[model samples]
Target: MTELRDAALASKAWPFEEARRVLKRYAKAAPEKGYVLFETGYGPSGLPHIGTFGEVARTTMVRRAFELISDIPTKLICFSDDMDGLRKVPGNVPNQEQMKEDLNLPLTKVRDPFGTHDSFGAHNNARLNAFLDSYGFEYEFASATEYYKSGKFDEALLKALHEFDKIMEIMLPTLGKERQETYSPFLPVSPKTGHVLQVPTLERNLEKGTIVYEEPDGERVEVPVTGGNVKLQWKPDWGMRWAALGVDYEMFGKDLIPSAELSSKICRVLGTQPPELFNYELFLDEEGQKISKSKGNGLSMEEWLTYAAPESLSYFMYQKPKTAKRLYFDVIPKAVDEYHQQLRAYPGQDLKAQLNNPVFHIHGGDVPASDMVVPFSMLLNLASASSAEDKATMWGFIGKYAPDATPETHPGMDAAARYAVRYFNDFVKPEKVYRAPDVQELAALEDLVAALKSPEAALEQIAKKNAVMGNDEPLPEADYGDEDFLQSIVFAVGKNHGFEPLRDWFKAIYEVCLGASQGPRFGGFIALYGVDETIALIEKALAGELG
Candidate 1:
């Protein structure tokens, strides 16, 4: 009993709080099955984008959090909305001309221009599954095409058919005039062409569960609600899907608020309550423009995994999920560093604080006994400066700092090294920024070089100059790995040399070393990049060689 209470207390973090609320509300009115559920959606209109990864990753984090707080056995569903008609050819996908010919057909009925799967929907579905499985996601995949065709939705289809008029009343107000004129809760998939038609429904036979529609070819035909002959229009389909699956909870982007609200009303009319919902704000580009699958304005999942770790991406999803996040490539470095901080700081934190730490959830509560890897941002900086295409680049410097590390034992180091190299090439190479240092900055750079070259004598000189600062923790013996080491050095340099605030000195340090005015913590960077190499950067600045 006490364990349960403590677990619930530890779940005070925002994601866990949301998880606890969602699970408890569902438990009050439990589904027929004893287990609870969480769901995320995917649209297979094109290749899987970063937004798709974010949806599933964020949902998985919540699932991990919910598991900590309660014993509710939860299931996460990755449902693909594949029954939707192909509206247009995506520019990025192959065989645009072929896909254009298949537009207006159900995605499941359209040609797989890539020739990888049976249909366009199946091709993208396979792509989605590839990354999700590679990332080790725990999910049950469901396809709308299979569900409808296999009669899995037949009973719900019947219920919706019976309540058609009510569903129409709920949907009509949300449509524009032209769409309103032709809108019906049911979209009949034409037998001749296998395309979901948008034309006005000619007749509805409630007793026979059939709808008649005039085909574009000028022949009128009736199709049964079962056997995949008819598919619910998107709004009604949302409600029907929830009722059919007994979904307990789901998350979507906030742009679908109106659609979700309409679906909730339709669900009520179908005699079941809507699932609990979380609407995350849209992902934006660096310019703050919204990312759309159609617009192709966001990064792809394959591109992110090419340069970074899944854990870093997962940590990004862990924070401020409800708030809008800028998800361009630049944001990846901070997330990588923050994940490192969480893992490093985790060992000393109390149980409750550890529960709240993202690394705990990122590992799904059974955190490894040790996670002693280099900070990702530091590695990115190190990798950016070095031309090494592999871990050998980082290993040369890493051996100088920590003689204990080798490929035989520290697998984490190897993985981080590779990611850092990829990150530098993909993101830092083209946009590398540099600034020249002025006179005071030059002297500061020279002092930094001097201290790094002669560590013991440098601290002796520092203590003699600033006695009050070095008594408790002497500079030479300090752990270079700690962020405090760099901060203290910057603080000491600023106080002794009359550079009022330390950020100026740190800024100068970055300008000289990294060719940027901002970077990872300097002490940490030196530890990862090597003392001699860092000192060379200061020497270069002193000689005006960088300019």
Candidate 2:
């Protein structure tokens, strides 16, 4: 534990770095509330997306890092602003026409389109909980409607009432001239109509903790700001929530940096410091446009899971988070392979190096060993070469390469095999463009086939030369399954045929034999797929039967 603490203090991993900043906040003393609070806020206006998963996942990474460094307890809250008025119906959901009538009402008041939960907010909230729960994130769910109506936020609401002018002063300059005139921190939910009204505050009565505003019908109504009758405008509400919950750390998208800054000032006005903020760059679609829940242009969370493991998604989220990344199907295979690479490297790494390893932060220090005997790329190629329709088909080759591995013993590999088959069929198969090998490529491939066919005969000749030279090693006795020896033969065949920049040779093999332009190490593929099968595959390519 002491060694881990020492390493964590100096670890350069972003989560540990962010956690250290959080640790500084409590350098003098722990909070009076006993535990440091971490929060990730959700709008609950739409279904939870990849971005929502990212915020919580990244925050959880930091929280886990903080746990390593500090003895003080910590809590994470997944807060949902479900009390905000439903401004418009989301295009993704069903029964949009029905939801149109519920506009201007709190999301908790809008009718559920799916007819499952009590309201739209509740339905989305349930989905959010299920999403987080599936990932096994440790968090407490907080609802704005529940907090406001249950009087949990009464004190904070009253404080905002007393500090209304101060909050207004901070908010006014940021708005346009027209909006500034009518802007008030409090949005009162009409008692008669259930609409959250955004109107100018005609009067403030701090003694009674009430605000007076004129409704659209020209009737003036005074309502207590403490109850569910009113909710603060988003910016002020953000600050008030931070103050009310005593959040120690919260991270938002880089797009919200200005809102974060404004909310910080408002938090100070409410007599509490804002949580430590980390602004991450937003994800972009394949076309480089910023991804949005409404636009629906990027990869969905379910889509990612369909073609890869959840950990791969986490791995994607964990990498260089401050830099904007393209979230698309093309990125999935690379993420999956690299995540396993990190896992494979973790056990061999030292304590400090392990601390910096992604799997360390990803699994909260209990990193698992990668059971992937076959790289995901290899599996994908195997799927393509074998025309695999299911995981069981890929496993036929996988079983030969790794005899002991099974669905029960190596679940990660089993899952990867399944993902590989799905990914290959969906993405790889459609785009494959096999071409006939040019003259030099054809000669090199023919040489490879000859070598594969008579490897034992060539080994006998090598053995004779070793005996003639009185060499003790006896040429190290390799069989058809030896990837390095087979790889050397391929390399020699290419070089013998005068192929320059040798990648062209590999590319020729992939394009001619595999119907792809790139692939796993040929040697490794042969070792897994078998030498006889590879020779047969090469013969097919030579005879123009592959494409």
Candidate 3:
């Protein structure tokens, strides 16, 4: 494990140089065993987006990295600012028009449209929890409502007032020239009149650091800090929390630059230690547009998990922490296969060693020399053989490929293997299988099928024909270049036919080509899967009963 750590230190993946510098500075200033906290302000105004996961996932990696280096305990604090007033209605909510009147109140005061929870904030919190739980992250959620109600944040609030002048000095420069005076250092909600104290500046008592409030009659009243319950403005509040919580590190999205700037000022004012900050770029779709709930252009973690394993999803998150990158729909399957390959490569090493290896972190581990070694296509093709075959069947095939590959009866192995297979099925869509063709195309496919005797020979001929004709070449009038055409050819020749839907047939073809059903072009797939087996399987499917 120490060797692994040494390797990680030497490797580029760990970013050890930057981390060392940051850690040294942190240790010098703070010294105390502060909780390493990752803070994200959840509005509960919309469905949690991929960006939410992006923040949490990256923070988790950093926390893990810290744990790897030192014994300092870490806490990933997911803060839901449900006490925040609703600014606008979320698109998914019903009767959004009614929310306008409810805007000024806390999110906890808003009605839940789904009728499943006590309030809108509660509903959103649960949804976010379900999403996070799927990733197996160990996290502690702190609700703004709960924190305020429990008075856990009171100490920081008091510190903000004491250091108010210093905090103002840090914050005022960031605001625009026109709005600088209007921006107060705090969000003060008066308990008496429910009126917010929207003061412009520290108007009086500069020497004593006391805030002076002017009465309607023009008399100045100095408010003394009797206890640690002063409402520090947003910027000061952030800094105060850092000192109060003793957060060693936290990451935020690039979009939160404004809030981060303000928080920095507050930290200076409160004279508290500020956490190390890592800002990550947002996840974009294939088109290079940022994934946003407002735009409705991104896939949620739930949707991604439907086709990919949690580990694969985590791998995608880990690949690059701060790069502005696009996540194509196809990346998941490759990730799944790569994850399994990594697991196999580090067969006997302890878990810690496997995690710290950069090669294992990215491309994946080498296949274990003693493990069952079947081409991915074989397992996928076998899966296409029947809907019931699933991941269990795939495991059986791997075991059969290597007699030494026995069923992992242990709970851990079974769970891990199940995750790998599920990821493969959901994320990898085999492209080799075409859709059902019309009768005319089916007839042409049948004629083409007749030209082959051996599966290998037939696939070779097809490849040659494809090479000579080019991918754009027109097939006979009946050929639509879809799964039905391929199935008709398979039906014409007897092969490993399975009892499944037409969709499964296409999936089987993909399995035969790529270890997963979704991937590169079919011509390339044939090149990869080998021509002989490709044609033989087609012949087998064509000759056998539809089952």
Best by lDDT: 2
lDDT of 3 by residue, 1-547 (tens): 6875565455455534334445565554545655445565565767676667767766666555555555555567887777665667776778676765666556776778777888888999998888778766678887766776576776665566666667767877877997776666654333433233454544545345446554334555555322321245555656666776766566777887778767866776666657777777887887889887777676677676665446667667776667886766656556655655655667666555665543343323332232324333334444444322256755654443344554553333334445445544554333334334344434433544453334453454444555543654533333323334443344332222221443544444444323344433333333323334445655554544222
Between the candidate structures 1 and 2, which one is better when assessed by lDDT?
2
Off by over 4 Å in 3: 1-11, 15-22, 26-30, 33-41, 116-118, 190-235, 348-533, 536-547
Candidate 3 TM-score to native: 0.66
Model-by-model lDDT, in order? 0.78, 0.90, 0.56
Candidate 1 local lDDT, residue 176: 100
Clash list (residue pairs), candidate 2: none
After superposition, candidate 2 runs with Cα above 4 Å error: 456-476
Cα TM-score of candidate 2: 0.96
Model 1 RMSD in angstroms: 3.0
lDDT of 1 by residue, 1-547 (tens): 4774576555677668778777667555665676777888888887777778888888887787777667768899999999999988888778888888899899988999989789999998999898799889999999998999999999899888888888888988888999989998888898898888887777888899888889998999999988788888887998998888877788888999999999988888888878888889888887899977667676666666777777888888878888898878888778777777788788898777887888887887767643345676777777766655777878887776668988668876777778878777767755666567787876766666666666564565467546745556444565445445555565566556767576777777776666766777777777777666777766765676755
Q: Pick the candidate with the highest TM-score.
A: 2
Error of 3 at 266 (Å): 2.7
What number of backbone clashes does candidate 2 have, counting pairs of residues 3 or more apart or in separate chains? 0
